[model samples]
Target: MSRTSGATTSPGAALAALAGAQFTVMLATSIVNVALPQIRAGVGLSDSGTTWVVNAYGLAFGALLLAGGRAADLLGRRTVLLAGLALFGVSSVAAGLASSSGILITARAVQGLGAAAIAPAALALVMDLFPPGPGRGRALGVWGAVSGAGGAAGVLLGGVLTQALSWPWIFYAVATGAFLVLAAAAAFVTTTPVRESGRFDVLGTATVTLALTALVWGLTTARRSGWTDPQVLGAFAAAAGMTAAFVLIERRHPNPLLPPRLFAAGRVTAGNVLMALLGSVWIALFFFLPLHQQQVLGSSPLLTGLGQLPLAAANMLGSTLAPRISRRIGATATVTGALLTEAAGLLWLSQISAHGSYLADILGPSILIGLGLSTAFVQLTALSVEGVARQDSGLAGGLVNTTRQVGGAIGLAVLATLAGTVTAHAATHQPHLEALTAGYRAAFGISAAVLAATALLAAALTRRGSTPTAGEPVPAGPASTAARAN
Candidate 1:
């Protein structure tokens, strides 16, 4: 069932177009993670140098997200999306064919820039295409599900390609997916009128991007170089100075990249915080869990990938059911329940021992986390855009996604540092294997705490009420006020 131009397309078709692009972008981001060791070996990279491969992409993507959203609003979304896909595809091929670590890292940075362009544009497009009702709710629900499933699929795909073929095959596979999505988007997506009146906030964009990049890089480097290191301290100082400048710039600029008014509302502030915390927990799980399955459990790459299938399936089911459940219970309650469930699941997962069985110890907790993520994601998307005017929807959507990306990047860096610290401490008294497992446990415990914090934030912040039925507008609230004020 293909959607064609000028045909009355179903909500499912519209969602497929949006979700397919999201899935491809997410898959490209994560599929490289599991194959990092192989890539490092292949390209003869030192441990410090290897970390850059992932950080380069994340830093670029997170920093440019808001600017990308503004660009989508200025230019046509369809045009920007197609351009992003093409850039991503070309970069993927470049990374796959690279013979040196430097070349691959540079290509990955380019891919991040492409992803920054694609993600916010894709989300804004969804809000544009779907009306505010049950149809839009269902579409967003599927969108959330596809995103969770895509993360798991990336791990599986990475493992499969790295084991059966080579690490480069992962990039090759992503490139193929990007091309397919590009074709579908070109055929089905309709063009909208460009906004000639709105001006781009170049100063705001540069300041904010630089500030965030510096902050994240400093935090990440502090893990490896110690908190007292000159480079770490200097980076943090630079970040602080730049952030202050960004605030000043935004206040003065007529067209700001991130409008200060967005943070004035209590609910919007809370929602963004929750999104960031949830993102951090989710990214930590994907990064560390795979390591445990392979290194601690002594499983083959294929078996490790297979072990994650149940979680992926459960995530899909949760996303599919979230809309209906939210209608019955309310969005706030649904999100709260998801956060608690995720926290509990992570806590349970931290109890796994070296002698634990996969099905007995891992599968149950994995399923719980999957359900929690699916439910929270759906609610987050809904709440982020709720009550916003049509014109501000793009900015609202961009903020939600930007929070997630930045949170994920920050979380991964912190957790990696924690893991290293635990491992080093344990190694002073025990074997390497024992130390590694201990580190994994400590990391999971911290992740559980983060999820718990997010749950509390959600409970405190989210407003109580059912979403509007088909063809109805979202009720006015603090979140809506923030969007407009911005």
Candidate 2:
């Protein structure tokens, strides 16, 4: 079976449409961070309840990814893409208008559901546009860079909107952007023919979706409740049981939502592991550094976001050079090297003083971490989806994203627990600012260690001299052809 045929439309315009969708959805994820204070004050939400505003989105978005990915294959990319965006737009409207915390959190969850559909479909379209080659690499670089920039840019944009207008404007702006993306998509994205038939794996979808939801819910809930809380433990246990059952069901089901073989592939597995680790670091940087700037350095939210601007620029630069670096030394070495660089940067950030400034403490680390993270985003994206069957394009896309999101959620939870405990202990012996800085430093150091371990594992798993590719040879197996199974 052939992968996506080349786009009949202008590829550049098509890239813009797809990349724009990516940017918009990702922007939604981080935009709320800067506006959290306003949201809490305006909506009369308590500190703890407001946390759900973001967690609700992350949980739902991460949970539905597998179903969303496979739906694009069974239904159609264009259909799923538009439908997702419409849902996202409507939810954004609801959120902007919401007065109660419950209403806003509910809307964010729905928005996340829309994002789940948009992300995989948008990525699949980009792959369909540029087949495996230098062209695909270049396109993915643009795509990854834009997506990364959105995560950073969202804070700046959110701060501006929240300060100038109100917190609601953040939702309003994204909703408007969603409409524009829809317009561009309608014009540039070609309709995809549904390539499969029969029942979408209902059992598999239910089990996996529930598993992921439970996992994310548990992780997010752990921050408020201690990690040892019975509720948290139960949620995690249920997630594990459900995941195991899903695997068992997939093994026997005629048309599984996730093909076992896809997960079994060497490149796919290795890339996903690396993606998860890098995701942890990426998230740590985004979450902790901003807090450091605001709390430790006493900067405004707008300044905190603007300080990250350099990191975004460095990300673009790294993305541009990733393909070249991979070609010269192979994807394995390049990714491994990038991980080491990321770890080094995190190590540098761990040295921040209680009275540190952005330039002295944040700038250099931001650039180093951004370059390393962006390069890995490019290479790992290429690797995870490498040689995937045309039929599983959306599934492959979703898998990569799912790992990143899940990893970020889990890693953030674990790190938060560690930091809080450390800070509490240090508070007894040190000043409040120094104690807080100590917690952050410990988190950075631990994150660096985690990245280093992933780097070593990546070096072992990735083949020597195997360059990252837009087109690699897919192993034909039950997973690749299960859509046609009886």
Tens digit per residue, CA lDDT, model 1, 355-408 = 777886799999999999998898787776666544455666678878888888
C-alpha positional error of residue 415 in candidate 2 after TM-score superposition, expressed in Å: 1.3
RMSD of 2: 3.1
Counted clashes in each candidate structure? 0, 1
**Residue 100 miss distance in model 2 (angstroms):** 2.0
Using lDDT as the measure, which candidate wins? 2
> How many residue pairs of model 2 clash at the backbone?
1
Cα lDDT of model 1 overall?
0.79
The Cα local distance difference test for each model comes to 0.79, 0.81
Cα error, residue 188 of model 1, in Å, equals: 0.5
Kindly report which residue pairs in candidate 1 clash with one another.
none
